[model samples]
Target: MESGKRKIRHEFLALRNRMSVDLVAVCSAGIFAGIKKLSAYEKAKTVMFYLSCGSEVVTDFMINSAFGSGKTVIVPAIKNSGDEKMYAAKISRLEDAYLFVYGIRQPEINSGNIVEKNNIDLVFVPGLAFDIKGYRTGYGKGYYDRWLKGVPFEKTVGLAYDFQLTNQLPIEKYDLPVGIIVTEKRVVQIKGDRGADRWETL
Candidate 1:
């Protein structure tokens, strides 16, 4: 099962890396627009987002917009230690010289900026691939999955391009599914009760 996930991740990574800059921009814009229209996004008092890197969908627009939308913005940052863990750090602005993880810049992690798990109303996730069922394959560190375990599933969302969606993935017991996924073409909400899913095309 792990091997299957690794294979899928590799394929998705290659596909994402081949995306032209203009294509990424266009797709990311569409995905963010879909996110802005979500009722949950408007009502969210505090939202957590992952800063984009490489050919990944750009999230700076969403983060910047959140800053002025009267919502507290939090990003994941890590303190280098033997233990590999990510902390949700609330940031007033994006700055440099904090730390870098896999080419992605992260803010300084400290007690003052760490937000409580319950304070996050919405969390924008990063993944290599996701299935229609909302299960996602990340970089294998399991940082986001562990964090998601503590938050209400309905509050988490994944952002991806349309091609990143797959039919299914090998699900692990520790894995948690996102409640919503916004692609370049649509917004998919997997019901919290795991009943019927709602799909909205843009």
Candidate 2:
């Protein structure tokens, strides 16, 4: 099982690297559209978004757009050792950063209350690939999975570029799935608990 997981992660990372220029443009458009659609279902006043790296869908627009929408914006930064998952800290703007224990950019010291699991309203997740069933392959770190364990499944959304959508991903006992996979192209809802169905590429 460990070997299979490693292989899958390798192949998926290769797929991401091989993405074409045209695919990136289309995926970005799809992600913008998906975010528009998701705005309607959001009811939480405090929403969590993450900073992007590499080919992750650009979240700057979403973050700025959500600023005055009456919802407080929060971003996650690593707070503890690698063994501990990333933690969320409230921020008023995108530029603020503090040197957290893990050396990652985080909210200012004592800027806001520490994020308690399940206290979040909506969580915008970034990943390498996600199936229609909502199973996602991340950076081989269980950060989000560990942080979201007790949170209600309904509030989780995997935000990705369309190319990152895949037909299926290997699922393990500790691998938690998202409730919906949203790309710039479309939103794929997982059919059953823990995403039992094969993921259909967006």
Candidate 3:
């Protein structure tokens, strides 16, 4: 299973890397627009967003917009310790972030700015590839999986470009699925009791 996942991850990463910068920007804009239309996003007081890097769908627009709209914006920052864990840190401005972990921007570690997992109402998950079932293949660290284990699945959403969607993906027991996936083309609510009811388009 690990080998298969690694193969798929590599293939998808290459595909994503080939995408044009303009296309990523346009798709990310559409995705954020769709997110704003969700009831969960509108009602959430505190939200966690992954800072985009490389070929991933950008989150800069979403982060800035969240701050502008008075929502508490929390971003994932890597712990410098040996355990390779990640924690959510609150940021009032984008300038608070510094590049870390493969050049991905993250908020500086500050005890006063750390947010409790329960306080986060929503989380924007990152991934290299995803299936209609909401299963995603990240960069193999399992950071999101471990971090999300404690959070309710209903509050998690994956953002991806239309091309990132695949027919299916290999699943493992520890794999945490997103409640819904927002692509540039539409919003897919993975069927299950985990959260959400049906899929819809923007």
Cα lDDT listed for each candidate: 0.85, 0.71, 0.86
* Candidate 3, residue 156: lDDT: 92
Give the alpha carbon lDDT tens digit for every residue of 97-178 in model 3.
Answer: 8887577798788789989889999999999888766789998988889899888877899999888888778989999889
By TM-score, how accurate is candidate 1? 0.93
lDDT of 1 by residue, 1-202 (tens): 9999899889999999999999999999999999999999999999999988889999888888998888999998777643477789998886632547567678877779999879889999999998767889999888888777778888888999999987677889988888889998988877656544434343
What lDDT is obtained when candidate 2 is compared to the true structure?
A: 0.71
lDDT winner? 3
Tens digits of per-residue lDDT, candidate 2, 16-117, equal 767776676577676767766765345668788886555556676677878867777778776456446567777787677555542345665354656665
- Write out the backbone clash pairs for model 3: none
For every candidate in turn, the CA RMSD to the true structure comes to 1.9, 3.2, 2.2
Is 1 or 2 the stronger prediction by TM-score?
1
Q: Which stretches of candidate 2 lie over 4 Å from their true place?
A: 18-26, 39-42, 81-83, 98-105, 108-111, 195-202
Considering summed lDDT, which 10 consecutive residues are worst modelled in model 2? 102-111
